[model samples]
Target: MATVHNNSLNRLSAGGLLISLGIIFGDIGTSPLYVFKAIFNQGTVTPDLVIGAISCVFWTLTLQTTIKYVLITLNADNKGEGGILSLYSLVRRRAKWLIIPAIVGASTLLADGMITPAITISSAVEGLAIHNPAFPTVPVVVLIISLLFVIQRFGTSIVGRVFGPLMLVWFSTIGILGFAYIDKAPEVIKALNPYYAIHTIVHYPNALFIIGAIFLCTTGAEALYSDMGHCGKSNIRVSWIFVKLCLILNYFGQGAWLITHQGNVLGENNPFYAIMPDWFLFYGIIIATVAAIIASQAMISGSYTLISEAVRLNIWPKVTIRYPSDQKGQLYVPSINLILFIGCMLIIFVFRKSSNMEAAYGLAINLTFLSTTILVIYFMLRKRIHKLWIVLFALIYFTVEITFLVGNGVKIGHGGWLTLLLALTIFIVMYAWYTARKIKNRHVKFDDIKKYYPIISELSEDETVPTFASQLVYLTSANNKEEIETKVIYSILNKKPKRADVYWIVHVDVMDTPHARDYTVNQLIPGKLIRIDFKLGFREEQKISLLLRKVIEDMVSKGEIDITSQYKTLKKYHIPGDFNFVVLEKVFTKTSELNWPERIVMELYKILKNFSLSEEKGFGLDSSFVTLERVPLNIPNTGNLQLRRVK
Candidate 1:
């Protein structure tokens, strides 16, 4: 049976649609604030420029956001869980090289997280400059960003409640605002023609740069697919219809306003604010600011989710994750939050303006979109979609994305290199963590548990050895029921010779499905040895200490095992026996020989291990009852022994 993963708002309902609007659409929804302004800044505002830009925005949303993500990619969910990693998990068996795109997509998306807040919040706050030209927006932006990160520890459930309603208002206001201006330049509707989009690029000056600016409108498209798990596919798909309409209206409305001011340079005057009525400008600014905050929140929360998933997938090092609320899937990672906060602060100080930050924004996300495109094509291939359909889908998106990439390539010299640099740094960490594990696994040796059963049985009854615990448990990596790690046997019979009344070998398998929590128990020896295998989803918390207790309780209820202490004095009282856990930690040894890449990976892995959570902590085991054993990880040197003994 498939495991059922439930979110309160995961079902299709009015509430779900509202939540989808709030959570999934924040990044793309708020693009109207700066997209037109960025486009207008590129060249003179004319009939061709305004209409062409709006047309490009419309098709990008339709092709990239609406068709690609909402209609198609949302269907590729892994047991209703969606993200680059989750998608990778679904089709990963199809190809090994798929890991490259998954890592690249995730890293770039995370890089986008840092710039999204910096750019969106700065754009909203910069509206203050309209009223007071000398107002310093940096400190205000910094304060908002800082407080946003600060409150992340307390959870966002309370604040999250207002997101849907607030975003609804944001979308409605922008749509209405856009509709009001469309009458000023009815011909702006001509932007719907593909000809205008083609002509603008072919005839317009700096056309490639315009396409780069236009790419910003669909930046939040990936979030729709990533967050499909939070809100079901139905909710996201339905909410997107309404969202796309409002976004189109707002973009067209801005075009209308800009067309009316043709031939005049829009000198630092934002067309977004310019279209608003004098009476509603302040209110509009306030609404935009709140929407910007909502967008930032979505990105921040998404970053946390991404890092947590990455950790579980073994691509990222283990870090401390705390659940501050009773809500499912709501977690806070302080290390990630601190890193994002620092990245945002650095962008604000360095760029100092949303315009400059915009130059850095779309480039990283373009790479992310291209990576998603690559994954989706493979996803289609896996589904065995018709060859013609798959080829057409691949050709269209690859061409569009590569074009966007080249257009955004212009940003490399301006400010785009910053986000690319951030993404590259993140990729290195994931690559090193993942590659080191593969290398480590190559050296690990397993022993047949059947061969040691008699020896362990003898050790349990041996009066010469002192008792280690009433019940001793070891977490094992061996997947087969009849096998255990050679080191595990070494630890028991060779290292210190631990004796116990009962021995338990526990193994946890992280599955691709998001919420699996089933386990199977086997009695390797009656009343002497037990093996329990837990099949948990990647997103499931690994609280082995608590989960083991629950498993023991269930076993006790079923009369599967004896819990009474084996000691003579305690046997009379019928008290429960003590349980101790042994966690083997591998330490890198200098004697191990590796190729250059392996050595580099192991060296970085060593540094990362020092900073990461301990094995016991990572497994969610209690420290007091857990024994940490350091095991050397040594690969045999291919060369002959250098030291020779004198006979």
Candidate 2:
């Protein structure tokens, strides 16, 4: 059961609520930094456009973020765990095609992971350049993002406590500033009317295109649901009330400021900072920078959880994971960390400003939103929820998201392609890894254990065969105790004729539950052959060596087996016997008989296998006492060639 675990689903409390604010709201909370500016960037800032844009922001947040995600999607938690993957796990058995949406949604969320930090930090740091155009904010952005990544190894347990208070101050400041300005232009409140949202689309020249920026205001909504398990639904739902209020107040404040400057172009000047009184500018930038960093932290943490689950589900290549703290779901993957750092640096180096990075941002996450929508609808259907609401949910989200997708599509050449490209790359890897596993299992031959029991038992007592180890163990993928891989049989009898006092077969079954840990043991032979099936949750790490050792200790205490060394002197001294593990490594040999698709899958599987963690480390086996055996996965003589008998 050892791995990074998140207990965010523990209970409803003040601490949880605060953590929810600090963590769950970072993405959406920081959006005021750039969302309004992106809308104005598309064209001239007219009163109608400003009013329509603010209206779109309000309604979009209401419909997209609040209703769709916080209210509906958050209900589909996997054992109180929420995320696209978690939701998929709840109903994946309902249909095979569901895997597609799961993979695509998860990939896009990860893509969002890359772009969010770049844009959030870039937006915050851009405030410095706002005051002094000569200020070098690029290096500052790089430095802040770099420091965040560097600290992941230490864990966020210590700093996470302050995220809530920090965000509290940020929201309070934004709300106060916005409320203060609301008096300047009370007419801006008219934008909250849904009519203004519809009017913007009809009257604004680039209204449809502005949906891209509108999508940004709620980009973090999915993340909110994703982290629901970390912060109980009650905590999230409660904190959201405050978070949304402040966010709306700030958006309205910024709107109030924007409408005043109508017909006057605010080029390269952010309304968020512009709306702030001059005295508070420095302090405001400081608070925004801190909030942005925290936002980036939450996103990065979410990425780790996403990839960790992907690995456990066998959809992604295995990588080394380190638990930097006892906190649930706190894991550090060096590979992903480095990849994100490089990606962020690339975004900073290429996009150069928050506005440019914004162009690359919301495009991929819209795909994520749509993907989650499909899963959520199916999940509701499975729960026997009324069909009427399901259809309504689907229609409303599809209409809004498709419009946003098309709007973001216009940014394809303007850096949007970057995130889409990264997401597609991740999707391919996941698809390839998933399909290759199925293909590999398709050709594997599982033999009846009864047929081999006699051979195995006979060979165990045969003194002529060399003693392999006192206790010989093999990890098996077979779910049935009556079956074993034929390769294991051949390795035991034909390869080196390994003989041992007792043979142990271990099978691990990954359950869908987040933290389940139940196991069953079968004693096929009282003193010679034994089988163990461990049922672990996908979130649980497989520490086979340690677990097996504990199993042996329990057995020894019960006098089930004598594991003392076979040597006379050692047995006299009561020295414990040695245990050795045999790990099977597959080597695929491409034959001409393989079809193109099969070959492609096998080739990719091999390439991925090369980069993936080795079976020894992935399974948490003790390398010092393990032996690696390579087996050829060659098709058994597909005699398709018509040849003369040359011999």
Candidate 3:
């Protein structure tokens, strides 16, 4: 599997890699805005504290970001796909224990998706105040958010194209600024050493005021794993080498600028913008704003993809999925967009400034980062990828990450609770949905085709039902007996006697991997009605219509079902008559026999059924040729009695 997967490394192109870097690296790229400012503002630190803090940031990026993410997590990709859900899908069977971490990581990622844009964009907008203190922050923040929502409808391709160049400029600008400051305080360069990091922590005891402050440098490191499909592992690996170098240089420059000026302009607030010359402030604001928007774009795009993956895996409720491009992984989900919009607006309204939002920001990113670390450990152990190396690396990185998380955890009383609360809520809903779906599916008797076959066979003969009815297809579960029963009931109730013709219960099983084209079909119950079930491989995204067409063609070629029978008119040599679809909707009761949580989940699932793709579409039935007969079953109690039907 590793050898087969490694083949994708050859497919990475220069242009694609650059775009991936631009999109995937945006979060970490913009970290300089608040990371340094947060650390130096209120945190207790002696003169040597700068060196130690910078040392921790450097090493954290090396061990946590570069080593854990770029090296280890990226290797856990499921067929070139990476993300919390993707990782979960791959290892869920082998390392079921890791599912907890996967869920936490994914939930936190969603939380980051909501708060990142709010914080990043606000930080950039706050840069505007540098140009003109009179610039109203709240209105500008609202306007930028409104425009972001407006453009999301069109999709991000156009915006993505601009990201690369803008980020390039931002990096270059920071690089130049760092170099200018490096000329004056070259001694600050010593901070990159590990000794400095330890010295600052030990010598300057107060330096621990906000331990979570270091979280800024490593915030988006998870992107290395989350976006493996969009940007190949090698691309992120290579791009980060340069990105990290540039960032370190900039941080060092900021350190130098502060040391030389002795924090003269710091004024207990944003020294990031304050350090720059007045002439460059306007350009810096523009650059920062663009960087913020790009960071927000990455968050939005990543969230859409994550939710889409979740839906495919049945961890999330079915939502409308739109592919704006033929590009493999691109997707747009509307519900997520609206939710993010509301959350972001509220954050801006409440926080009002980027500095305040900082307290709330790192919580989600750190949580997500820690979750990924735990999963990566399991991933490595499962693959036998050097146990000692994996354990040692995970222990060191986890300790550092948890230390930062503690700081962010402290802010929970402030605004950090919002992210954690939202994450937990989403996690519960998603986990409940997945658990309920599994339990309901488990109880379903998929093999009961015997009970359904008779009904389907009878339906074929009924002249009163629909004159155009010829081809009858029942969508059933995998179990043969249950499918037969479902077929029989429909045939008996709808059709009169029974027509001599081909009938079958077709079951479509969706796979985890995308673009899965292969399937298996069974011809059970012989001539009158066949129970055909398709077991799709993980890589295939199942479409019932495509699979059915294939099944029909295969059967016709084998002389099992006549190819010449007219679908609309029954003829012995033609393909059998018009198609009729029968779908069995899962009925739920408030007082179901299942546990309370399961019952509640089923109720929600029932509501969601209405919004799911119609049976006609799901079963590959043509709009003009399909008729639906919905069967409602009673919710069983201790006694079997038909109560008044409730709508």
Ranking by TM-score: 1, 2, 3
Candidate 1 lDDT over 1-647, as tens digits, reads 00112576688888889888888999999999889888877567788788888888988898899888988889899888888888888888899888899999999999999999999999999998998999998899999999999999988888888899999999999999999999999998888888888888888879878988999999999999888888899988889889999999989988988989999887688988888998998899899999999999999988888898899899999999998887777889999999899889888888999988877779998988988888889889989999998899999999999989999999888888888999999999999999999888877889889988899999999988988998899998888899988889999999899999889999999898888999999999977999999999988899999999999999989999997887899999999899999999866676246788889998899888887999999999999999999987674565877876898
The C-alpha local distance difference test score for the whole of candidate 1 amounts to 0.89
Ranking by lDDT: 1, 2, 3
Q: Tell me the TM-score of each prediction against the true structure.
A: 0.97, 0.96, 0.87
lDDT top scorer: 1
Candidate 3 — which residues are off by over 4 angstroms? 1-13, 43-46, 95-97, 202-209, 263-269, 446-468, 479-500, 525-542, 550-560, 563-576, 590-592, 599-634, 637-647
Each prediction's RMSD to truth: 2.4, 2.1, 4.7
lDDT of 3: 0.70
* Model 1 weakest 10-residue run by lDDT: 1-10
Which runs of model 1 end up more than 4 angstroms from their true locations? 1-8, 635-639, 642-647
Give the per-residue lDDT digits (tens) of candidate 2, residues 1-647: 11123463347787887778888899999999999888887576677877788889989999998899888888888888888888888888899899999999999888888888889988888898866899998889888888999998888877887888999999899888888898877888898899999988877677656888788999999888888777778888888998899999999898888888888776788999988988999999999999999888988988888888888888999999998878767778888898788877877888988888877779989999999999998999999999999999999999999999998998888899888888898898899999888877776789888877888899888988878998899999898789999888888889899998889999998888877877777888877889988888878888989888888888889998788877679889999878999998866665456688867877877788888999999999989999999997665575766777875
Give the Cα lDDT of each candidate.
0.89, 0.85, 0.70
Model 3 residue 434 CA deviation (Å) reads 1.1
Give the best candidate by TM-score. Answer: 1
Per-residue lDDT, model 2, residue 309, is: 86
Q: Which candidate model has the greater lDDT, 2 or 3?
A: 2
